[model samples]
Target: MSQSRRNFLKAMGAASLTAVGAKNAKATPKNVLSDDRFGVLVDTTVCIGCRQCEYACKVEHDLPAGNIDDYSDRSVFEHMRRPDHTALTVVNGYPSEKDKQQQVTVKVQCMHCDHPACVSACIVGAISKQENGAVIWDESRCIGCRYCMVACPFQIPAFEYHKAIEPKIMKCDLCYETRTSKGQPPACVEACPTEALIFGKRYELIQIAHERIRKNPDRYYDHVFGEHEVGGTSWLYLGSQDFSKLGFPDLGTKPAPGATEPIQHAIFKFFVPPVALYALLGGIMWLGKQNREEEE
Candidate 1:
């Protein structure tokens, strides 16, 4: 690894550790800072591949509809399309039966990692992990560099490619401003006809997920997607077959993107390193100036 990357990782030590501290500090801040608001829990095994949620997202956000007229069509899906500017959420088809082409689809959107890479990669701090579980970006603060796009491990955090002015990071915010703030679910979850997507407290949802698994372990995978991956996630997944089979990469338990900041903070931000560095530089400059004056 390069020196900068190595230095960054060394500085990020404590924040990356899984070991409990003297006490487990509260994680209820925001998606980036901590888990503040509640989040959605998606059980892929139950998802019916209905795109009502996608249509709802476009309508809620006032985005122009691009490709499909029929929400249920599986044709365009032969190609993998992720969440993007026009489409805040895209359901990808995962072929299950090798011979029969029995497919299962998982809805892709911001996983809303507890340590969101989008929040850290953003230089202007335009994007913030809200006190709620949502990661929100203020367009006014955005310079449109698209670092958030590059930092996301899930490859989420889409940008407004069409807008010439006041463009911003465009992705799911769990409808924090509209639905979640009002104590209602997001447009996508609301539009799901089947109980495919459920919204509630993260703790409660974990319980519900476990119950579903215990009832029918044979029907669902034994693993929970977002629980401990890179610290935790507001959104989670439960699938019947292997997650990889459904376009889900086996990420093992690493925190998702934007995770480095907290790690950065825990190690480097504690001692006021900036102040120390400034002091050191000031001392050096002063010494050099004094030496030059003596020579003159």
Candidate 2:
């Protein structure tokens, strides 16, 4: 083989080794969720589809503060909407069998998982789970790769696709900087007229949720939506109908990252896969060189 071919082969081998080393590297210390962590209980049955929470979230986040009256427009409920870069939280209306004419509005935002997959997927340490149970993203540290979007089970993280430069990963932080850190309720909870959203310590909230379910057995589903989903989320939900009707995924009691992490770690640590990948690429390059030489 020519000297250039030898050098190319050596480069590919080195790259394969480097890739394996990077993938097999030790992860950062896991951020454990405290029992005293703050959380919110969203009682969907009581929610009037007012969209006051959406307006409150926007105002608190310093996003577009449109006329508050405009939020009352129920036409927006025609389609299911996800939290985008422009809006951190959105209240979606789901049909209720109990109420034929009216739909139950459920607020959608970051679940702030106890074992956050976004934190694990973020190679740049952009995302973090706060002790208060808020999952926040640091724009300065974010590489805008959108891995967090893929990692999040709820698909909470949204990228700023419109911005040409320095776009941000946007999601709910549970108003940690504005209110939760100061022991005040989030803007949505505070602004809720119907007391649909209750904020307190996560353990306390879970107890309250169970009590409510027990008291009004006919009013709510027996299970709290986030209590054990994805190893428990900071935000819990209660609805009369099944959560699947409210667009919530049936994620089961197991944590999302638990099933995937081991497989991902082994793929890189074993080295066989990366070596084979590089070998295939190198072979293709060699074939291209041969074809070019024949033409010459």
Candidate 3:
């Protein structure tokens, strides 16, 4: 091979390695879970299906929260709803297994995993898990890759596909910026008329959840939903029936990243994939052909 060809190959190899290293470093999460980090305990038994928390979340985030009274219309509860770009947190009603006449209300939002998969999936480091147990997104840094949306076990992160410009990935940030940072509970927790949502240190919340289950063995399902799911989450839940019956996914105790990170790291460590390598070599060969043609 020509000296120029050797130099080109060396440069391409170095570039590929550097790119892989940069991506791996950027994808790694910087934040560590703190012992003092806060969490919310959602007691579904105490919830009234009033949808007050839903209204509060919208109002706090300055979303298109129509009249507060509009949330009282129970017709919306007939169909299941997930949090989207407009609403970061939503209250969903499910029929009680024991009594079809009675309804169980569950509020859903970002679980804010102790080991957040979204943080590990964001190539630009746009998504981060804060020390206070809030998983937040930085719109300025986000390239709208939607990797976080795919990584999240709860399917919480939402994309603004409708917007043509400056679209956002939206999810509940635990009211970190507006409420928790100032030593206030999240708007949803505060607005819960039945006081079903309790906010406190994560560890404390877990203890409270278990204690509630212990005292009212018949009332609770004897399981704290988020205590061990996806290596624990900041949003713990207490339910009358199994969490799955209330729309919660049956995730394993292992962190979501634990299942995929090793494979990703191995691939990146090996430099470019086969397809990328072929594309790079093809480009190099085409460039060399052009150079030889110019000389002729």
Query: What's the lDDT for all of these models?
Result: 0.79, 0.91, 0.90
- Residue-level lDDT of model 3, residues 228-257, one tens digit each, is 999999999999998899999888999999
Winning model by TM-score? 3
* lDDT string, candidate 1, 154-236, tens digits: 88888777878777688888898998877789998888888799998777788888899999988888877788776678898
Ranking by lDDT: 2, 3, 1
Which lDDT tens digits does candidate 2 get at residues 92-156?
A: 98899787988989999999998889988887889988888898999889988888899999999
TM-score quality measure for candidate 2: 0.81
Cα deviation of 124 in candidate 3 (Å)? 0.5
lDDT of 3: 0.90
Give the candidate order by descending TM-score.
3, 2, 1
TM-score of each: 0.75, 0.81, 0.84
TM-score of 1: 0.75
List the pairs of residues colliding in candidate 1: 30-34, 37-132, 37-133, 116-258, 117-257, 117-258, 230-254, 230-255
In candidate 3, list every pair of residues with a backbone clash: none
